[model samples]
Target: MKPISFIWILSVWMSLDFIMHGASTDPFDFDQVIHFKIEIPDAGIEILRQSNFQRRWPDSSHRPKVKAEVRINDEPFKDVSVRLKGAAGSFRSIDSKPALTINLDSHIKDQQFEGYDKFYLNNSVQDRSYCNEIICRELFQRAGIPTPRATHATVELNGRDLGLYVMIEGFNKKWLKRHFDQIGGNLYDSGFLKDIHANLTVNVGKNPEDHSAKNNLIAAVYEKDLSKLLPGIMRHLDLDMFLTHVALDTLTWNWDGYAMKPNNYRLYHNLDTGKFQFIPHGMDQMFQNPQGSIYPRFRGVTVLSLMRLPAMQQQYFKRMLHLYGTVFKPKQLVNRVDQLAAVIEPELKKRSLREWDRNQRGIQRLKDSIGARGDFLGWELSAPERALKFPDAGFVSIRNWKTSRLRGDIQFRNANENNKQVLVIESGSGINIGRWYSQQLLTQGTYRFEARVRCENVVAAPNDLYGGVRVRASGSRINAVLTGTRNWTWVAADFLVSQPVEEVELSCEFRGMQGRTWFEEGSLRLVKLR
Candidate 1:
């Protein structure tokens, strides 16, 4: 489709183009309210409402779409297809008011609102304040990321008001062209992928039939040499933008982002620079869990790898502190929240008013976060902090043997607790994964190793089989193999440490897809047996 095939399809679409663009960067001006009305056919209404009860997380291509007429302000465009969007968010199982992606181009082919063929309306069910999506996006845009512009709307469907909703500018070529100098490139949607996997879905771009750009990225990820890895990726990625993106992600405490998982992000390969940039999405739950360190060191492979370098860590912290001070202003933000609430106040339902009131009381919450994040991060990165000291067999720091090829992601939870050391394992690809060994050294002797492990949703294909923690020493292993699913069970093994190994590897190794396990606590006692 040609860019600018349509512009200002709805009068409301015009105001969303940032009427206050240069005049003033005020976050919200409630004086200008965009009203949206959608009239769906009875059959289409049934399909849309059916999604309210349907429990499934499918790709947008697989989502059920029905024809409807969407009216922005006074104009009505007919025969649009509306369907649920997002992974868990799309599922009505959790939210009866599921998020929607309306596709006007799908039906009319020639019809589009502005240049956007599609648009996103997210249910602000989680955000009682109904301002996080808007707040975070504005922050990202000001920070120079190609992020969506969000504004609240009073949405009515078939004369039934749906209450307060945040309408996000759809991610497409037209939107990209607006934010970027170069717009022609592949846009890969991360659907439900919490990490960069070989099976990631392609939203837009070349099929990679010959595996051109994606292959180079995968090769960089698996490249063992740190020197070569960064340089290799630098060729295909905008590193500065990536760092800024990572800094912003951690600073905003978006645990659901690419840093923490492989989900809620889009990859745009800029053919201009011959590099890819990560565009942020799913900002509804910003600052949901803020107690976490500003540095998400244990998260995404990209962030983790970058943080591993001293210089990159310094650079990340610098950008984080700068953004916290500059882009994020607590008083200004709270004012924006108030402005948004005030403008949309007339459109709010009475029940929503109560929630909005309740949410407004916590305007101080975000303000407090804004005020604290700078100092908090400053103190965190001010000095070289030492890793927490765990008990003798307290905690384990695990890494894959291949490092580059395939490996399991190991993270220790509650390392300070004496009774138990919980480790969460997100199994990586391939079978020959390295052990999750301890950092401390082990003596030459026989030892009894036991751990309490619980497997949840441990999925495996016919050929794939694995899971469980074991004690390894003297080239021998006493381990428990985990598969299918189970509750907390003790997995024990005895092994002789004939040679004094630098580390006692308590290996809970698993390979294949869709597997998650928790290693709660373990004990290593030197056997007195002669």
Candidate 2:
């Protein structure tokens, strides 16, 4: 064979091999930013506008697909379905811009562009930084949780510029493939699973109709055999993964997820392991402020139930500390923000000067968060076991307290013929419950809660209604209940605060009783040992 012929043949073979076996485009490669355009037809835009009214009026609400053209880096693509998306944050039906969902398959046959079948073009109407979802999703992915990737896009409809938008990866079968080897399995979109017991919507799976996995998981959570609950949960669920996911959400303060409410997450019955896994979704809001605690105190029932166990709680705190040290690095995260901003800033400037200025400030604020958030959380993780000591009587005077009833009278009057004053609760049908609250979240400790109380004619409204003081720990409910009637009585309890923010709130209640009650010398003394 001639040398020139041999060289040409070898080059051809190498090019073919590269085309066949080369890696797919990395969806989350943060160095480069993506700019995409959505060109919806005029009729489609009108339908979207009309759909807004129908969305508000459920009677007329119907999801109708409309064809849209897309351009990626000036590369035109045809046939994408654009639809309005969102529940609460679905504002701007006409102008502010409603969140959008684009189905790529709507235009191309069996098309999987950039390894993603569908994409979510969030208007980001609520986010000031316009990168909360992007940064938070990155945080979760870094912490080993399966989450979506985000980038900024330039959106257009009917030749009209719609400004910059955050293009998010949709949570679907493609997401499952990216996260798990077992692609074809039961995938449930636990979308707004307000009640865990209720059935979850099957988003993508072989047995799309099978809800057995979610049902069994819920049953295990409410299992009667408390001793077997942990083992039972471990059987079908990935506890460590779920806990880490929760910790990531907490660390980022993504309240819209399972921590604040059992929503914005997905459950996948992985075929590879035959076990269910929890994945996070919907992260438009995060790092809003540095005020709230990183630990959610297991506010949701899913975590609440498991965290009640000592072993689970220990593992959670351990994982949290580990993640804090290794994954939640402030400098690296801030660098990521700066990198994304660098790519996005130039395009953002093309939109408008005012927008560029506003977005830059927001980006800087996010960068500031990246610098400061780690230390804030580190302080929380390594918080000392300090004594929540109290002052002498009346020294901790009322910061403030409010009653549930719209119309209730609180009067200061002398009681027991003494000069000491007491807060008197008097009403026709409601009872006087002198409720005192602490100003700050209670940390781990033993608290000595005491109050002087007296009630007259405490009605038995229910099976057994009584006037009492209720102490609620952060992770649990109503640890102790104190009651008194017809005469002066000392209501007190020794509260155990095992979790941070354990003494989150205090409540004094007189359930469905029509009577008068007086309270004085309320004290929440921390009990400590020498």
TM-scores for all candidates: the values are: 0.64, 0.70
lDDT of 1 by residue, 1-530 (tens): 75653554665565765564634432233334566788767876666654542224333334568877788767678888787665555444212456778777776766865456667888776666677888888888888887877887667777776766788877766677776677656677776654664456666554444347866876776678878877887887799888888878887778788888756898878877888889999887777654677645456777776655555756776787677668866567667777776766666546476756766655556556655654565555433333223355544433332122244443333342346666555555433343444433444345555566676666554564333433443344535576667877776567654322224444544444556666663443223222
Model 2, residue 415: C-alpha shift (Å): 28
User: CA lDDT of 280 in candidate 1?
Assistant: 92
Query: Any runs in candidate 2 off by more than 4 Å, and if so which?
Result: 1-24, 53-61, 94-96, 192-195, 297-299, 370-372, 384-495, 500-530
Candidates' RMSD to native: 15.9, 8.9
Which digits, one per residue and each the tens of the lDDT, describe model 2 over residues 231-344?
888887888788898788777777788877767777788878777777777777777655457556555667888877766766776777889888888788787787778877
Q: Each candidate's lDDT (Cα)?
A: 0.63, 0.66
For residue 123, model 2's alpha carbon misses the true position, in angstroms, by 1.3
Residue 294 in model 1: shift from native, Å? 1.8
**Per-candidate clashes, comma-separated:** 7, 1
Over all chains combined, what TM-score does candidate 1 have?
0.64
TM-score of 2: 0.70
